[model samples]
Target: MSPDTAPSAARVDPKLLRIAFILVLGTFMATVDATIVSVGIDTLAGEFGASVAEIQWVSTAYLLAVVAAVPASGWLADRFGGRRTWLAAVGVFLLGSALCALAWSATSLIVFRVVQGLGGGLLPATGQALLARIAGPDRTGRVISIVAVVPLLSPVLGPLVGGAILGTASWPWLFLVNLPIGLVAMLLARRHVPAVPPSERRTAFDLRGAALLSPGLAVLVFGLTEVSHGRTLPAAAGVSAGLAMLAGFAVHGLRTRRTPLVDPRLFAQPPFGAAALALLVLGASVFGTMFLLPLYFQTGRGLSAGEAGLLLAPQGLGAAAGSVLVNRTIDKVAPRALVVTGIVLILVGTVPFTQLGHRPTDALIASALVVRGVGMAMVSAPVMNIVYSRIEPAHLPRAAGALNLLNTVGGSIGTAALAVVLQNRLTARGPDIAQAFADTFWWVLGLCLLAAAGATRLPRTHVGKS
Candidate 1:
């Protein structure tokens, strides 16, 4: 925001700026809903008198439906047009939100949430496609900076908002709040988002590819969550069937002449593959921790939901600051170096969480969140720059879809896995709630370390190699 950098930041046209607003609004509503409802789980459980395992479905169902829709996004957008498709998606999400607010029981809420997820999944995939198309190849960092804001900023605020609503109003308002925001997003899409008319030149829809990947991913995520919940037979069946279908899709994409829906071929590129892995690790680290952080404050530290939310706001603020600083300098260094640096910060920032005890000071926790936020901004903001700049422009939609799916699945699985770990540790560790939660933080730290190491595999720059 300094005078020197003002012009570079303003490189995108007014039309694209308008489009970016629409995309970010959709992305914020979709991504924030995934976690905002997370804080309300226990409240919903109490309201419906449901068990912990049963209430989990309220969140898991939404995530699974998101996975189901992810593989179809690129093709759907291509066929229907991005602007039209985005508007429809926002409209569907709004409808789902309204229905969810009216849910009379836990089962009703879970079903309505699935409806929300189906629409939510399209927002990020199409949003990224629009962003990449507008920014062009050279200015990818700018688009990434724009696209990254929603994910980095929303998680910090979601719990705070969810907590405030639950504490003041009611659980239903959690879903109801999205209604006005989503309507505004849909309205903006009309003027800003360009309608890509179906191209005679575009590849035919790969029914085989769609058939294989979408359900494959859905069942795969379903199986993982079930396994986390300690269900055996159903989980086994789902995992086996899902993996086989995904394997079938990979083979189909390789042998067929037509383009695949979720092309396995994109992973072959070094930069693309590296960015995908980075995204997976980033997703796992950010979301898995987001899933746990509020609980840690509320349960371990005995803070109220509202207090816990206020405690976590620093992370979002730090991320906003980090993005501004990192984007200004990202192009000068090799992405590998920059990404690794971000991971190091993540490791450092996250280390503090694993060591907290009873009645930890507020400043200590907020500082940790601030550091982690900045770390996340550094990693997430520039990754799409590496991916979009490296891939062929025509492949943008599919590539965008595939990467977004990886993130959703990675984060969901990571969150579920960590929750399971926390459950087991609480039982095993003699009810030392702080230690059990700390044990879960160790798992988060492991994810960050894995991500940091993986970032080194990204293509090296001449300066980086030297």
Candidate 2:
């Protein structure tokens, strides 16, 4: 079937399911790469004789590259076929991984990580476009839940996986590990992923819009990163400029006859607009907190890297469980119900973190994380799927890019803001590390509350077909 006319979601065929499963491997790898190096920051600092702040650039650079590359995915997929574009992206990622593994210095490693993120950015957006084209709006939640499995698990498991590698192997092995998995995924995609013939009608690409969108997001994220270092004035200037550029792009997108980088009209639709906002906050609260948790275990509690990772594994396990449960109940539960209930659970679970004193028991932390995991799974998967339900088949790639971009941008902002707050408190007279972490966790809870409020704005159901 030509993907230009999307299939009915209620009748997802065996071939589509198989193709979705294949694409998820790439998604898993991309999401894992986002957080895998986080636990290795300390190890990299030790090996390179750098400080913790210096090594953080490794993560910041990758995130910045992702912000830059994501807007280009839609254009790439439209200009090249999904199959060819996807293959090229995975190849680029593998090449970057190889470079990162062989990096001789801290600067070299950080630069290679940027290369890796540029490649990694395309995977999830392209994969979403692929799945959305085949499954259509009716069963978007089910397929999206499957596609979402890795992202939910990766943040929790990444640190653990990285910790294990750092414990047993050199820090380089973190990048080295992507080699085999990426190859296998590339092979599967080549064999099974459907090739959609390019459309006869052309929407000319907007080079000016693309130029403005990518760097604006990158500069915005950079400004947030600067906030962590107490660079208030410079960060403010960068942020203001970034906002102006983005605002300009939005205006240009609305006025353009050409195919702009992202459609400004998407925000007018309830499913895409409200759900996107919900995801933005979820990213900040859940994914953003992911960056800080391992640091809390290792720095605040003085646990070994491996131990910190293991301590966090229950959250991932709970998230996996929640995804499975949602898979079974997706048709029965309303998207709004799932989002609001999830937010409530998340808020309740986070209450424990704010009260965690020095040396709180592992069982307590793990239990709370489990509940938060289930809540996050409910929020992230369904909200994302809801966006697809609103978009047309032809617009799936653009929608995917825009949604992924918003989520990542929110996550970078959340991580930076919370980190800044945490760092500032840590400099107090004889600072209590546990208390500092707890204080920052309260910020996460506050974000979740905002997300819960936003959930009310989402549609009660997908719009009926025209």
Q: Which prediction has the highest TM-score against the true structure?
A: 2
Off by over 4 Å in 2: 4-14, 49-51, 232-234, 358-360, 428-430, 462-466
Candidate 1 lDDT over residue span 262-290, tens digit each: 77777877777778888898888888888
What does the lDDT read for residue 34 in candidate 2?
Answer: 89
State how far residue 182 of model 1 sits from its true place (Å).
1.8
RMSD (Å) per prediction:
4.0, 2.2
CA lDDT scores, all candidates in order: 0.80, 0.82
Residue-level lDDT of model 2, residues 1-466, one tens digit each, is: 6665665646556777788888888888888888889878878999888899888889888889988998988877777767787788899899999999998888998999899999999988888887777676776778787678677788877887887788799988999999999899888887878786444556677889988998898888888778788889978987888888999999999998887888888877777788888888887887767777778887877888778878888888878888887787666777788888888988987888887555668898899889988888888788877777766677777788888887877887888889888887677624588888888888888898888878999767544622
Clashes of 1: 0
Per-model TM against the reference: 0.90, 0.94
Q: Which parts of model 1 are misplaced by more than 4 Å? A: 1-10, 13-15, 46-49, 357-360, 460-466
Candidate 2 versus the native: TM-score?
A: 0.94
Worst 10-residue lDDT window, candidate 1: 1-10
Checking candidate 1 for backbone clashes, the offending pairs are: none
